[model samples]
Target: MRWVALTAVAPVAWGANYYVTHEFLPPDSPFYGAALRALPAGLVLLGLCRQRPRGAWWWRSAVLGLLNVSVFFVLVYAASQLLPTSIASTVMAVSPLAMMLIAWTLVAERPGIAHLAGAAIGLGGVCLTLLTGTAGVSMPGVLASVAAMLVSSFGHILTKRWNAGTDVLASTAWQLTAGGLFLLLVAAAVEGPPPSLSTSALLAFGYVTLVATALAFAAWFIGLRYLPAGTVGLVGLLNPVTGVLLGTAVAGEVLTVQQLCGLALVLAGVVLGQPTRAGRRGGSRTPLQPAPDKSAAREFSTRNPL
Candidate 1:
């Protein structure tokens, strides 16, 4: 489906994020990268969308951006400075579990036993992956990463809840713009003057802005419009998986058998968390019902398959 394809593109773009941050950007400049990546992209997207949000949509967009992008990026980049990318990513792997919990509490959307079990298994795998590291994990780094993921998860759940009546493009543009401004403020206060931007750093910034943030989020909204929320959440597991593989293949990072097992468990969890024919009965369904024409459905489905 169109949604599926669009959603699928997100993880692929995100997979390259670690490398772009670690290798391309200068050390201790993650915040700088975050600022550059978000602000311009936000502006571009906002210009393109050119639609104003009404009423509570503006407040919701700001809140979502603060949680999902500004705060999340700060914690993640800071944690990455102190922790290995793999470890940071492993910590992020718990996002689905967090989103599931939030959905249950706020929306009364109970996760089935399979979803819970899979989340538990996936979390365990994440723990194993973290434990396998010899470089002693910093407590602050662990806490920061976990906090980042939790906030990001909350943002995701909020987005799902709000997207029902909102204009996706307008919501996204506002959120990104808000997040960008917050990041810029942080960068100005905490990081002071930007470092001498190198060519690689510039490229990384461009990639993050154009590809990771803008394109990926656009794709995500498209996918969310068609898929079940849980399915969309579960598909996020691919993010770290692709990150790990790319880290190994491109960055020459080592992967032990335990880590491989962890990957397998994560994949298993994703599969188990997916909606079966029965499980899709209850949940927040997208209102933009597919057209009756099979060709229209097929085209839309190709871009956004559930």
Candidate 2:
């Protein structure tokens, strides 16, 4: 339950991030924006952890970095710029299903009946909230958001698979640092110089870097360390919930009674998917457990932790 609460922090921070990016950050410089957000946050965590990737972790970190940070960040930035905060965040709610399927295939964590049902209920709520018909939807933004969801879902499950014995902070820092540096190089080549920042933009970047990227990723990975991927993904339902409420409160988006009801359903789904003590005991082992088999890949991963 404490892990559930801590995991909730990531999506909530990410939810607020949509509004901040849409309202304050430079829209035309997504590459630079992503690079800036990831790099500083990575450096901060690296400073704290004071450890670098060793052995196969170097390549693993690079791959996860590309999927989770480099590409996903740019797509999310594009979606945030092109769509309303509520809509952009709602699109991401579909990631629970995606994560479930990916986890089933990649890590052999079968989706429980409760998890599937919760995803269904949560997705239905997403539709109800998203179909407000008040704001015009952008097709490109929707595509970008969906792409971000799939990429992130796969990357996150892969993180869980390989992060068995690693310090979550160190591994997260490595991915962010690798991804940020890659983005920086690419942004320099394609986007020209980094964009100039206004005072508001700098402040927005600070919040995005420290809170959303660094703290959120650490909390999220920590949850993955303890909980099943399906459970963590369902907890992510709060991302859109926060986006919708924040949109209503700060962005003056309409909060219909229907949307409020949808919020209830979404929260219910989140609650439904939480791990009971019985569930934890009866279900497949989380990544924190050592594998029973002495497979080469398992042995290799064990030898080169994180």
TM-score per candidate, chains pooled: 0.85, 0.93
Estimate, for each residue in 124-224, the C-alpha lDDT of model 1 and write its tens digit.
77877778846677889889888988888778776766665445666677888888888888888888998898787787788988998888887777666
Q: Give each model's whole-structure lDDT.
A: 0.72, 0.88
In terms of lDDT, model 1 sits at 0.72
Best by lDDT: 2
* Model 2 per-residue lDDT tens digits across residues 244-279: 889889999888988888888888889888898755
| Every candidate's CA RMSD | 5.6, 3.0
Model 1 misplacement above 4 A: 277-306
- Candidate 2, superposed: residue stretches over 4 Å from native: 281-306
Model 2: how far residue 73 lies from native, Å: 0.3
